[model samples]
Target: MKGDPSPKTETHKITGLILAGGQSRRMGQDKAGLIYRSRSLLDRATDLLRHLPVGDIVVLGREDTKYGVRDTEPHLGPARAIRNWLRRQDKPMNLLVIPVDMPELGREQLYELLAHEKGAYFHDLYLPFYVRAAKASAVHASTERMRDLISAFDLTELPVPVHWRTALMNINTPDDLRALEERQLG
Candidate 1:
């Protein structure tokens, strides 16, 4: 979807959502804390999004701001984290959400993805191909005091460039880290 263009505007419209609250299991550590280059993966991901021309940048994490994270409350899965982050916003806006582990993502790739998104209705805007957000307060309303209903949206994948495929890689294992390091060195 990154290659698709919209007729409404040439610049594209969207917000940046950084998913950062995962309890890392496979990596034997918090995936966002993994160091890449000179900064932690969390710092790198947030910085990359900050450089984008999006409306707002929200960090969904579990109280870790030393890396410059704003920290969203009501930590849940990526789905819930995203919704809670969205609810806190002063205004409604489209989002470009991705996990913290995707450290190699480039600004031009993100902009290209935003250019192709379209909304189903006026208030219901479509996000990038990687993920989409919808107003689902009621869907998550039935689970105790928790907003568990606010989960992942219906995803529509976009085909990115072959070299950029690593940009979506979520480092989950030692091998994964090794592979990334090798790629960096090579």
Candidate 2:
């Protein structure tokens, strides 16, 4: 169920929510603030989301962006972040959720996911998902595993483009980032 893509529409009021609230245990610092190719991951993620057709965009950490929502409940992870935002919404919200550390996720890559009305998943990499507001309550009720949330909805796994495969990985450590750099260089 985690890697599955369910049926649903992709139109209207889609909020591009950059999930930048993680504790960055692997990176030894705030990965969101880390610079990748001269731009901070936070800036990079927000810029990528801006190119999408989403109605609004918000960063879950760091106020450097135009619209930033400080994590009111830190250390709790993505579910807490979603729950916190859900309480502030007037109705069910459609979210194109991305992580700050994913430097390889570009506009084109996101469009692939958006192409599916039911939403998309990365198979093994369950993040950068299309989260429907209707399933938020169910996710909260279920396991905290981010995978479980996608499982509740029918999500289709977009075939990873050969060129974008390595880059799509969530850069969790400096080594991971360096490996990406090496791949690019070599």
Candidate 3:
């Protein structure tokens, strides 16, 4: 069910997806379940996204209860997971895809991405994407072979201003999380 669009709406009237199926080799634990400020990393991300201009939020993970999260894995890797999300979505073909490991995302950063780019792409391991869901989904679906799909598609990077770059940082290892936690504490 679609609601009337309003400036007060936190999320766009688009699909909001979180990538959370990583094996977490470096962390040696489920990154999505990590705690920050007393909340699970995924929980914090979900709270942030709730205030965005998005509609539905879907989480793609490897198993239904691996991290005790509401959303489970649809498949492995971002491309495969998103393909599943796109298949399930019945709304407009636009989506805001963020990672589960990014616990520090803020509204200002989200609005900035929405304002400047028709879509957003990440060069790093984990970052949010604002995109035309159909086109992005098509590209993701076409890939079954292990390839550098982002480079293959020639998707352009939506330049995030310097100040907002830190907001996109993702937790790939325990050391990375420790650093981020220190940064947050400091």
**Most TM-score-accurate candidate:** 2
Clashing residue pairs, candidate 2?
A: 4-155, 5-154, 5-155, 5-156, 6-154, 6-155
Which lDDT values do the candidates have, in the order given? 0.57, 0.74, 0.63
**Model 2 CA lDDT for position 52:** 72
**Model 1 C-alpha lDDT per residue in residues 96-169, reported as the tens digit of each score:** 66677767766666666556444221111122233334443423433322123222333334555567667656
Predicted structure with the largest lDDT when compared to the true one: 2
Tens-digit lDDT track for model 2 on 16-106? 8898888899889999888888898888988887777777888886565678888777777886676666666667777788888899787
Candidate 3 residue runs with Cα over 4 Å from true position: 1-12, 62-75, 88-92, 122-126, 133-137, 144-156
| lDDT for model 3 | 0.63
For lDDT, candidate 1 versus 2, the one ahead is 2
Order the candidates by lDDT, highest first: 2, 3, 1
Scored against the true structure, residue 130 in model 2 reaches a CA lDDT of 75
For TM-score, candidate 1 versus 3, the one ahead is 3
